[model samples]
Target chain A: MHLLVCGGTGCRASASDSIVESLKQELENKGLSDEVQVIMTGCFGFCEKGPIVKVLPDNTFYVEVKHEDAVEIVDEHVIKGRQVKRLLYQDPEKKQSISDSKHMDFYKKQIRIALRNCGFIDPENVDEYIGRDGYMALGKCINEMTPQDVIKEIKDSGLRGRGGGGFPTGLKWEIASKNNADQKYVVCNADEGDPGAFMDRSILEGDPHAVLEAMAICGYATNASKGLIYIRAEYPLAIKRLKIAIDQAREYGLLGKNIFGSDFEFDVELRYGAGAFVCGEETALIHSMEGLRGEPTIKPPYPAEKGYLGKPTNVNNVETFANIPVIINKGANWFNKIGTEKSKGTKVFALAGKINNVGLIEVPMGTTLREVIFEIGGGIKDGKKFKAVQTGGPSGGCLTEKHLDTPIDFDNLIAAGSMMGSGGMIVMDEDDCMVSVAKFYLDFTVEESCGKCSPCRIGNKRLYELLDQITQGKATMDDLQRLRNMCEVIKDTSLCGLGQTSPNPILSTLDNFWDEYVAHIKDHKCPAGQCKDLMKYVVIEENCVGCTACVRVCPVGAISGEKKQPHYIDPSNCIKCGACIERCKFDAIIVK
Target chain B: MSHIKVKIKEKDLNTIKQICKSFNNEPKELINVLHKTQEHFGYLPAEIQEVVAQELNVPVAKVYGVVTFYSFFTMLPKGKHPVSICTGTACYVRGADNVLQEFKRQLGIEVGETTEDGEFSLSCLRCVGACGLAPVVLVGDKTYGRVAPDGVKAIIDEYKK
Candidate 1:
């Protein structure tokens, strides 16, 4: 019998480490240590009910296991062969305990291709990775196939880049292989800078060896000797795990020189990015890896012809490489049969923001947004009304409830005015103001713009100012037209992908939530009540019991009332802090 | 990118010089050197940038430009306890703004500023990849998940002593 404990950062934060130790201790005391094996694995992707412990062979899954329950788990589940009824995952709506994850709604719809081995194997242990057919693809590429044949297989699989831009991966490899350079390089763009996106980081933390093996296969295909992984410095855990995986692969003679007794030699090095969001662009990422300011120059020299000290280089993001081994193991035709016509594989999403199941999820391409948000994500949090879902980070746009039934793919999302940007599906409820949401993304873009081009630097700043004005109830309807025109100008003239798509939030929100913007402009009212400047605090006279609770808690002394009389709030002095609302027990304070 | 007038110890200066040498004093290793130096020191001050520039044979203005361009690099020192609140999309929808305001009200400082006693500092990070714990707050290395605005004072009080 085996007990798999979640060792991801989320579970670790919830003290899954102690639960692992306690489980081990209890099993040893029971003399079942020889019979039961305790293994710590990566993220289960069901983080809403994390610190998950699953007993294998019988497939008994436990949710939210506390430290003290470790002894009971051993007493009931291990020794006596009985299940812990309370520890099982109970459905929020059904109120029935689920014994297996396969039957759960969260896991039933998720087709785990990129995350196949994430929660199943111990990442730090390379042998465990190999046990799941890890480096077999690298061996197969080196022994059975030539460089051209490998690229042909990738082309046949119709695998496109998973890094926002859906450029064909095979075409990129072919371009780099065709270029004649003495020192070609393979680069992995692990600098995942999208806000609310953790797909790449989770993959690296869960299965580091998959990325390394794929990079090796990439090296054999592209005739590259040195590989560099440009990862963000913020992801210290992923970096540490990748370092371990690299050292182990080298120690096992799978990474270094002449792998599988062939005349192919390749190795990978790590380059740390210093928190630059613009570095997600390939050229900027290349510049950052070279220890520069991470600013992008125009393409056409395109990393393939001249990259990394002026040598041919191929760069693929972490998720794209995670799929390579699978495509090689299962034939191209089998892999290509899934997903939509254009986008031929699955996409991993960091499903968060006002959602019931806040976690990482991988679903096949062309899955409707409704199915992802409702079926897999378990619907909106707190049973709030659905407003919109933002995909592709700041560079992407917001889609309303009308677009939920639209199939999610590269072309389809673009047609709906959003793109499949590195799969950050942030679901927003009715509480979120569409104007404020656009302003929020603009604020991010304004800070992250590299100042390389005039349109991006100045245009984004101007766009942010207009949104700020709208939120503050100071904008005229003329400013709306200015915002729309400026978005097109920036999209047309920006230097990198960052600026070209920076105005997506504004464009998308304006297209879908036009009425909300008009309400903010014409009536000077924010329907969402999110904008502080537009909100007014008033005491409902009928509900006020004159308890003086509001007066006592008002920070600026903005509320006044006589003993046993209705209270009044002086709006000018009220800082809009909402302190009075919290203090009011009689429901006297109303915000309009 | 401007520098403050401050005295620097010779030993600390040598550590900075030694780090540059380890990278072969290459101009392209500026970002890597900055990352390592920042790891050694809590934050990068003007004196450290000057030493790095002198070692790498780059202009002082260029090093400052690079430092200020990236949000990761900081010119000021952090407090004994650095508190980073995630304002990612997940956290924002869960009312992280209120949580941030509560921390600011308690610390008497803005997002990037440290308290007068240097006991605590406030900053905002994009996402720490722990969205399951939305509205997450981190004091030094310990993470406080599902933080409410009402709980901000207790978090600050725990590190006060």
Candidate 2:
């Protein structure tokens, strides 16, 4: 039986590397090292229960496997062919252990298109990638099909850009092809700057060769000889894996001159994005690649006509590119039949924040939020009520329980007041404050604002100040009106996509959770109890035994009372550190 | 943006020149050059920026603009063990703010400030892509996952030696 261990960043952080080392060492000790080959692969998307180890042939899937469990895994599972009962994924609801992951509902509703080879193949080994028809599409495009035919195949596939904007990918390639420039460029936008989104990073980390191969295919279709992957510097692991994949592709003559023994040459270079959120925009990305400040320019001269040193360029998101090879391999008719009428394929979502199954998931276009959250995601964490789910990161808005049944797609999300951003589906529960959540997004947009335009740079800052006032319980209803008006103006006048969608969080929250904002404004009370400025740390008379624990624990000396008597927390001096609450045995100190 | 600079020794100047030369001193390689220089030196001070500007044949103001534009480049030097707390949306919702507040309380330093002893410097990052461990902390190259406000002291106490 073969062992596949998750080497994704999430698993790596939990010392999945040591788990592999111990597994290999233990296997050697048992003289079964050759018999049982341990392969370190990419993310399985079930990151909540990582580092995951899947035993092949029998299909025994293990979750949260520790390094010390290596001996048991090798001794019990691999040796005697008996599955490790405890290591198997225990269903949170039924509390029954699931041996084969194929039966789990987590993997059932999900249809992985872009993430087809992610958890299945070893990212470092090019042979494994090729074994699964990796570069067959590239060869087919170069030899069997013409550029026009290839573009037509993509167009017929009904694939749209997965990077927030659902622009037609084939139309973009056709435009770049028609530009007739002396030099053209194919850019793979791996700069996933969305705060909670990591699907792009996971794709690059798990299947780096897929992106490289797709970039080559894009280069052939667009007549671009050079490709640049503008990746985020924050993703060091993705960058490392991409570098390895590029080197391996070059060694195998898949990326270098005359790829697949054809004249259609394509090579990729890595351009590091040094923490600029605006760089995710096509214009800003091209400027950053030219070693300039990542500022967005007007869009009439889109990147298709002028980009990357003033040459014709086609920029596609990483997930979008990861879908190209699949669409090329499977006919457009086959791929288009899966999703909704408009959106044609599965989208990878980094499902996180107050969710039980906080992991990466890829589901088809028409999959409702209720299905993704309740079924695939295993519902909200700690049995909390599902408050809202934030998709498309800062650019996208907060989708509430009412919209959970809405089918998730590019058009559906936009119609529901949110757009399909880089697919960062952050589920927020009742404990999370909507007013504070809006303030959080406003804060991010204010910091990330490029200061190029007045509306986005200054108006966003003013909006943040307004949010601050609301959260601090100092805002009037007039300030709330101003916040709404400002969000509209910024969206209408942003020079780039960053400023345009920056106010989405505010607009979305105001649209869905208007009561939360009103509570923070009118009553000067935060319904979620998240606004510390409005909270009062009160000592309950009966529970407070005046044990002096809270008084001693209060760092600001806010609590004072007689020993064995009830204590009182002075509101003026209370810092809301919650230290007294932690120290109190009776749980008397409560925030209201 | 802070514009902090230290005295640049002659050998340091040579190192900056060499880094620029390795990338053929291309103006387009400015970001890459700065990344390499910062890897060699702990931080990118004004003196190093000037030397990089002169070698790359770009204005010093341009280098500073590029340096300040990206959050990765820093003008001030970081402590030996720079502690980073992820303040991404995932971590933020999972109570990263309380953990950050706890770190500041224990270290007696603000987000961009270093401890007086220069042992640890605290900073907030967007995300490390480890959403499974929502409130993630990074000390040097080592990653600490699912970090809580109560676990801040034990993490800092690790590098006490």
Candidate 3:
């Protein structure tokens, strides 16, 4: 039996590392060290119940295991081959312990294609990666199939780019393959800058070899001699693992030159992205890789034709490249039948915000928002009323309750006023204001705008100003109409994807929650009480018993009262810090 | 702006030269060289940018432009223990803003500014991908997760030495 402990960053922060040491010490004390192997693995996806340890061969999953429980696990289970009842994953609905993870509600509707090797193998050890059919696809592609055949198989598989755009992956390869360039390049866009998304980072940390192998396969297919992974410098763990994977692949002769006795020469180099969100755009990414300002230029000659130092280059996101090796190994026919009609295969999402299960989930393309939010996500946190679900980060929009049943795909999400952008699905509750949400996204876009385009740089700033006016209850009804019009103009005239989709959040929020916008402007009240400038902290007369606590805590001296009388709040002086409310013994202070 | 001659040590300058040489002195490797240079020296100053510009044979304006365009490249030096609070959408919804404000109030410095003594500096990162540990605060490389406003004092106290 093997003990697989979660080694993901989330679990590591929660002291999962110490849990591993304790488990190892216990196993050694019992003289069962050789019999039971303790291996630290990647995220199990059910991070809500993290610090998970799964006993293999019997498939017993123990959720929320502590360091002290390590001795009990080895003493009871490992020694006597008996299962620990209390440590098993308890089903939320049934309120009963589940011995096997297969029956859990979270993993029921999911398909783990892109995340196949994520939680299973030791990423540091390439032999373990090789043990799980790691390089079979690259070997098969080079030894048996031709470059054209590899491209055709990817074409038939119908795998689109997982990065915001739904462009066909194989068609991109075919274009680059057709281009006659002495030096071509394949770039892995691991600069995952989406605010709440981390699917790429998790994949790189969990399975670095998969991306390296896929890039090599791409190198063989596109007739490219060199590959560059333009990953973010912020992802120190992913970069470290990629370096290890690259060095290991070189040692194994899978990456250097003439692999499997064939004349395919491919080597990869690492380029760091210095925290520019606009680098997610292809042209800007290419420019950033070339050590220039990461600004986007007009695209008549796409990156397929002329890119990365004016050579034929193909850029695909980390998640998109991860699916390449799988499609090659499992045949096109087998991979094509999984998802919806147009969008074939699964999409990995970093499901976060107000959701009960805030972690990475890989679901089928045609799965509905209702299923994802209710089933896979385990519904909203603390039983809060679900108001909207924001998909695609700043480049995407919000979908409401009416659109929950809509199937999630490239076309379906676009039809529902959102796009599948890097798979960042942030669920918002009733307490989250739509106008503030739009303003938040607009704020991100304004900061991230490369200033290369006039509309995105200037228009987005004006749009943010308009949002600032509305959120502060300083805008007239006319400004709402102006906000709508400005979103359209920015959408139409932007230079790249960043500006084109920057207005999506505003437009979608306007369509779905126009009343919220009116509440902030006409009523002079923020519906969600999020905008501090619009909120008025008032001490309720009936509940206030004149404890000078509020007076002492108020930073601006906004509250004053006698020793026993009810306290009164000076609204103008109140900075809306909510300090008075926390200090009050009775629930007297409330924001209006 | 007044011209300042901020001196760089000879050894550090040689390291930067070696880094540029590793990339064949190609102007295209400007961003890569800057990354390595910044890693060696905690932050990039104006003087180092001039040296990088001369070494790679690119214009100083271009190097400065590349440095300013990316958020990761910093012109101002970070504190001894830089405090990065994640303000990503997930952390935002989970009350990371309050934690950030609490730190600012305690340190008497706003986001992106260092204290007078240079003990700590405050900045907001997009996301560190530790969503399960919402409202994460990083002091140097140590991560403090599920950080509440009340927990801010203890964090600062630990780094007081």
Candidate 4:
């Protein structure tokens, strides 16, 4: 029996490393180390119940494990051959012990394609990766298929890029192949600039070899001898594993010149992004690589035509490359059959913000937002009323209750004012202010702007200033019209994807939550009580029972009243810090 | 050779080595090297990117792509002390607007602006995850949470010191 402990970064932070070590020590103390193999694996997706410990063969799943319970796990289960009933994950609804991960509702609907190796293999170990047919796709491509054949297979799969743009992956490879440049390039975009998105990072951490092998395959197909993986510096763990994978692949003859005795020669290297949002644009990325300012040049001579030292290049994000090996192994038809006609295969999303299950999830393209939010994501947090869902991070828009049933696809999401932006789906609740949400995204976009283009540089600034004015209750109806007009101008005239999609949040919120903006403008009130400038905190006399709790908790000394006389919030002195409201047990503080 | 009068030829390789060495020995240091290089050089040039890739044993394109992805690290050389104000939900509610106004007022520069001296660069963050103490301003490593408009001067003074 093998004991798989979650070694994903999140679980690692929660002392999972010590737990694994203790489990090993306990097994050794019991003289069962030889019989039981303890392996450290990637994220189990059910992060709510991590540091998760799963016993394989019988598939006994244990959640929220501590270092102290390591002995009990070994003594009760390993020594006595009995299940630890108390340690098993209890179904929240049924209140019954769940024996296996498959039985749990969280894992019942999740179809992990990109995340297949995660939570199953020791990411650092090359053997574990190989044991699960890791570099077999590279082997197959090198040994069996020609460069054109591999490209043909990818084309037949109908795989669209997962990095927001929905560009055809096979077509991109074909373009780079058809180009008669002396030098060509294959770039793996692991930059993942989208907020709340950790899909690329997780893939690199859990299954680094998959991306490496796929990059090698891409390199071979494109006749490019070299491949580059461009990832952000923020993802330290992913970078480490990717480095290990690259070295291991090179050692195994899967990477570097004359792989597997084939005439095809290919190798890969790592590149770190300093974190520029505009660099996610292919042209800007190419320009950045060219040692120039990472500003987007107009595309006509696309990256595939003249890129990276004016050579043909193909760029795909981490997720897009992660799907290649699977497509090669399972055949194009199998992958083609999974998702919608246009958007084939599963998409990995970092489901976060006001959601119960805030973790990485991979589901088919056609899966409704309801299923993702409810079934996969375990619904909204704190049982709050579902207001809207924000997909595609800063570049994407917000979707309301009416659009929850709409199938998640490239075409469908764009139709709904949201695009699949590197798969960051932030769930929103009723308590969240729609105007505030738009402003938040605008704030991110405006800051991330490269400032190379006028529309993005000047227009986004103007848009943000207006939103700031509206949030502060300083804007009129005409300002809202100006905001809308500026959004179009920026969207149309922007040079890069960052500027083009910068107004998504503003446009989406304006389209769906126009009333909220109207309320902020005309009524001079924030319905969600989110806008602090427009909010006034007052203590209800009937509810207050001489409680000094609020007065003591007020950070700015905004609350004042005689004992039992019901406190009054001086609006001039009050910062609207919400300390009094949070501290009040009697619901005395009313925010209007 | 005199310290300040090193030959241009030697300086190029030294700069490349200096940039490459910043990444440490780890092959994964490609991204870190790129960030540091970009920090030194305003933007990543193909030659510099290639030098980093070659020195770190990584590919040029990979370095190029990483330079593009994140919002914090810039591929281009930016002014020192990237002053980021927290404009997240918590901060916005706690008069981050006023704090931002104070920054623009004091610096004579809007958000995402660099001063003429290139000493201070200003930008805004969605949230720095320090919501309990809203209106946070991150000047380099130090985060001055719960910052008020009146407090901006004191915070800037501390940085100046």
Candidate 5:
């Protein structure tokens, strides 16, 4: 039996390492060490119920497996051949134990095109990657197909860039291929700047070779001998794995000069990105790789025409590049058969926030938001009412309940006042104030604005201040009008994609949650009760136990009362930190 | 970014020179040079920026511009153990703001500020891609997941020793 434990960042943070160790030790203690091997693989995308351990042969999937339960897992599941009933993933709605992962609702709908290799293979081992027909696509491209042939196959595949822009990947390569440059470049944009997204990072950590292979294929098509992966410095594990994968690929003669023994020469190098969100833009990414400020330039001389030392460059995000090898191997017709006519293949999303199943998921392009959220995501957490689903990071907008039935393709998302940003689908509940959510995104944009463009730099800050004012219940009706007008100005006049789409959060939120904005403005109240300034902590006189827990917990000494008596909170002194509410044993304190 | 220059030891300056040289003193490799310099020294003060500029043959102002532009490069020295709260959308929606407030209340320092004893410095980062464990706090390399407001003090106490 093979034990596959999730070594993804999410599971690793939750003591997955110790679980791995204990499981290994348990196997030894039970004298099943020779029979069973524990392998740490990439993210399973079921992060909500991690640290996941899947027992192979049977594929008995376990969720929330603790180290202490390792002994029980070994004893019950391994030696006796009896499944650990308790450790098996218990269906949240059905309340039934799911023995196999394939039967789970989360996995049933997922096509797993981009994430096919993720959670299945040990990312570090090249042989393991090769065993699964890893480098065959690159081999086929270099040996059999011409540069135009490869581009034609990609164009026929109908694969658009997975990196938010939704530009045709094939068309991008064709543009760069057409450009006559002595030293062209292929850039893998691993710099995933979307706030809630992890698909790229997980892809790199789980299946680094796929990205490397795709980059080489891209190099062969673009006639570029050099490639650069501009990855975020925050992703240490992904960076380390890519380094290992590159070294291994070079050793196998799959990466360096004359790859697969063909005349095509392509080698990749790593470039680190400092915490700049603008670098996700292709031009900004190139400039950042060139060791300059990550500010975007005009697109007339797009990265295809001139990029990375004035060379024709083809830049594709990690997830976009990840789909390349699959499309090549499966053929464009087979790949294009899935998803909508416009959007081919599947899109991987980092589903998070108020959703019950908060994890990474990849579904077909035509998959409805309702299907993704209700069926696959297991609906909202804590049985809360769904409010909005924020996509496209700072640049994308929010989708309301009305748009849930809409198919989640690139065009569909954009039509719903939101773009398919690097696939960060953050579901918000009724408790999440729409106005506050807009302010949250504006805060991010205001800080991340490169300050090169006046509209994005100054206009975004002004918009942020307006949102802040609305959230704080300090904005008048005129301010709301200004907020609308400002969003248009920023969207229209911004220099690059960053400035162009920075106002999307405000525009999208303003469009869908008009009532919430009106509440904050007219009623002077935050409908969701999230705006701290509008919220007042009230003492529930009936429910107060007066245990002094609130008094002791209050940071500013806002709560005061004699022992065993109802405590009164000083409204003036209350910072609304919620410490008193958290410490109230009798639920004495409530936000009003 | 800080105009106030601090004195750098001879050993550290030599290391900075070596870092710049390792990148072939290329002006385009300024970000890489800064990354290595920051990795060596906990922060990039003005003195080290000056040394890097001289080595790379770029203007000191340009080096400072590059350093300030990237949030990863710190001008102020981080405390012995730096604590970073993820303000990513996933973490933000899941009461990460409350947890950050608790950290600020306990540490008595704003984000990007260090404690007086230099035990811990606080900062905020975008998604670290661990949204499964929303509200993640990183004390140096150690990641604390699902951190709540009440758990902030306890997490800080873990590093106090």
Candidate 6:
């Protein structure tokens, strides 16, 4: 039996490496090392209970396994032929032990098309990747199908770019192919600059071969011989794995000239993004690859027509490319049947924020927000009331309870004042303030703004200043009107996607939670008490034990009382830092 | 300003060539060249940026835009170590603002400013994705989570050591 240990970056940080070592030592100690093989693989996606271990052949899944528990697992499960019931994942809802991953609610709803090889294969091993039809797509494209045929297949598959824009992949390839250029290029926008998004990075880390093969296929389809992957320098692990995969591909005759003994030649290279959010845009991304300032230029001659060294180019994000091989291998007709008519196939989301199952998830296109949040995400954390879900990172908008059942697709999301951004779904609970959420996105846009255009640079700044005023409880109703006006102007006048969609959070929150803004302006009160400037901290006389916990923790010296008496918080001096409230054992300090 | 006609200096050119050679003519070496040039010149200049594009056989526009897109990179010169303060919800709730204030007070520079001595550059991040250990500040590669206002100096001092 083989013991597959999760070696994904998340589990790695939690000393999953040590667990593997300890398991090896324990297996040796128990004289079961020869019988049992330990294999380290990528993420299982059920990260809420991670550092996981699955005993293969029998498929006994163990969740939240620590370094100390390695001995018990080997001793009891490996040697004795008995399962470690305690080490197994216990479903909180059912209150029963789950032995296999297929039985878990988190895995039940997930359709792992893009992430098929993520949990199963060793990412660094090229042989394992090939064993799962890794470079077969490249071979099929080069030897069997022509550039036109491949593009037509992608068009038939109805594959839209997964990089938030949802542009037709085949159409993009066709544009570049039709454009007459001596030197054509294919670019992969791996610069995943979204705040809560790690879907691209995870794919690169887990299945770099998938992207490499897909890029090769794209090169054949677009008649581009060279490809470049513009990834952020911050993703050291993803970069390393991608480099290894590239080198391995070249060595295996899959990357360099005469690939799989075919005439079509295609190879991929990497360009490191300095971590700019705007560079994720195609025009800006192409400019960055050309060694220029990573700023977006106006479209007339789009990137497909005049990109990279004034040559015809096609650019798609990492997740978009990850879907290509599947579309080609499984046939377009099969993929077209999965999701909505317009948005075919699955979407991979970095499920984050207030959700319990906070990890990477790939669900079908038409899956509702309620299903993603409750059924797949395991609902809001700590049984907190669901407030709103922020889809599409900084570029996307917030969806309220009223829009929970709205099917998540390219058109549906856009209709709801939000776009399907690079698939960053940050679930927010009732404790989260909607106004503050708008401010948070605005702040990100303002900082990342390239200052190339007036609408983006000045407009975003003015909107942020307005948000700051609103959060500080210093804004008038006139200011609210100005904020909305500014959002519309910026959305309309901005040059690129970054500036155009910068007001998404503001518009979305304003659409759903207009009353919250009114409450902040009229009542001068933050309902969630998130805006500290508008909140008041008071001591509950009945609950205070006067144990001096608040006194010791108070950084601003806002609380005062004798050891035995009820402690009083001086609201005038209090900065609303929440230290006293957190330190209060008796729950005396209450935020009003 | 004057289209500068900015030809690569011999020394800088040699450095660029050597860096390009190290990556073995792979177009992917464009970022490495830019990074190394940035390290040499403090920030990416038009001349160095041009040298990189020419070396990698990539467009100059592509290099320039990439340099501006990412937060970790800079076109302007910065101090030695970048000290980034986490201002996410968890960190903000735990008095990260005061910690940032303390850094500004101690370093005599605001967020995104490099100290006069070129010792440290302070900046604020959305979140480093480490919330359990809130109020975090990252100096170079070391992350000091649960950092208080009073602990800022000591943390910087430890980095110095």
- DockQ for every model comes to 0.76, 0.82, 0.78, 0.12, 0.87, 0.23
Model 5: what TM-score? 0.98
**Sort by TM-score, best first: what order?**
2, 1, 5, 3, 6, 4
TM-score of each: 0.98, 0.99, 0.97, 0.84, 0.98, 0.88
- What's the lDDT for all of these models? 0.91, 0.91, 0.90, 0.80, 0.91, 0.83
Candidate 6 lDDT, tens digit per residue, A566-592? 988888898776768767777888888
Kindly give the stretch of ten consecutive residues in candidate 2 chain A with the minimal lDDT sum: A256-265
Candidate 5 lDDT by residue in tens digits, B1-161 = 47547988888878998998999999999999999989888789988888999998989999988899999998998989899999999999999999998899899999999999999999999998889889899999899999988888888888887
Question: Which candidate tops DockQ?
Answer: 5
lDDT of 1 at A238: 92
Model 3: lDDT to the true structure: 0.90
Report model 4's TM-score to 2 decimal places.
0.84
Weakest ten-residue segment in model 5 chain A by summed lDDT: A579-588
Q: Over the full model, what C-alpha lDDT does candidate 1 score relative to the true structure? A: 0.91
lDDT of 5 at A115: 87
**What are the per-residue Cα lDDT tens digits for candidate 3 across A315-342?**
9999998898889999999999989999
Q: Report the lDDT tens digits of candidate 1 across residue range B19-102.
A: 999999998889999999999987888888889999999998888888988888999988999999998887887888889998
State in Å the error of residue A86, model 1.
Answer: 1.4
Model 1, A160-249: lDDT tens digits are 999899999999999999999889999999999998899999899999999999999999999999999999898888999999999999
Deviation of model 5 at B139, angstroms? 1.1
C-alpha RMSD of each candidate structure in angstroms:
1.3, 1.1, 1.7, 7.1, 1.5, 4.7
